[model samples]
Target: MAASACATGLRGSLVSSFHGTWGTSMMGEDYPALIQSVPRYVRVGPPVRSPPCMKNVNEGKGIFAPAVVVTRNIIGKKRFNQLRGKAIALHSQVITEFCKAIGADGKQRQGLIRLAKKNGERLGFLA
Candidate 1:
């Protein structure tokens, strides 16, 4: 019982001390405006062109603006397959270049691929 009481008091003090460390200035208007004014540090990819059907619906919806904008990728099976094809092509090119750089023959390249697959399984990446 005494040990439990000591634990409760310690936890209460920790919570109170944490609460005390948060300053009221952090909630000030200037602080929020400053934070908002600072641009976000994240990768910005080019927006995909809208489809023909969507283009007709989007006409005259807003005033013409000349600023750059970034958007997330489309979420659909068609888009996924397109991106996957590109990724696979890139992967194949990289592996082919690496094998060529090491002067590996066809048989040696096959052996290397098998070894890589085995290692991936051992590392739980291909499991």
Candidate 2:
């Protein structure tokens, strides 16, 4: 009888200690209320979709479009445009002189330009 009473007392102390540490009843019916008392987090603004300055590299429509876009980004837009125009004019002049030296006609020069454009596209410059 004494051993049985001691066992009951030990079980009661364990239950009381558990209730004190957890701040809950023996059946845990207050768990939902405890969880509801916790603070919730909320976002302040809309989520980010993309970067602010995502320039489209496909805006330029030529065999050297990608190079032009990269150079434009490195240099200012105004300076890049000026340099691009001068380079294009120089390229045309050089091509015209080479065609004259080789006795090639306008049609042959145009075909060569088309071939270079095709090769550039295949190499993913148009991408």
The global C-alpha lDDT for each of the candidates, from Candidate 1 onward, is 0.56, 0.69
TM-score of each: 0.31, 0.38
lDDT of 1: 0.56
User: Per-residue lDDT tens digits of candidate 2, residues 9-112?
Assistant: 99988774343434446437877887788776744689858768754444466566677568778898889768756765676677778889999999998877
RMSD of each: 20.3, 15.4
Worst 10 residues of 1 by lDDT: 64-73
In model 1, the runs with Cα more than 4 Å from the true position are: 1-74, 111-127
Scored by lDDT, the top model is: 2
lDDT of 1 by residue, 55-99 (tens): 223322233211101111235546654665675566556777899
RMSD in angstroms between candidate 2 and the native structure over all alpha carbons:
15.4
Instruction: Tell me the spans in candidate 2 whose CA falls farther than 4 Å from its real position.
Output: 1-70, 117-127
**How well does model 2 score by local distance difference test?**
0.69
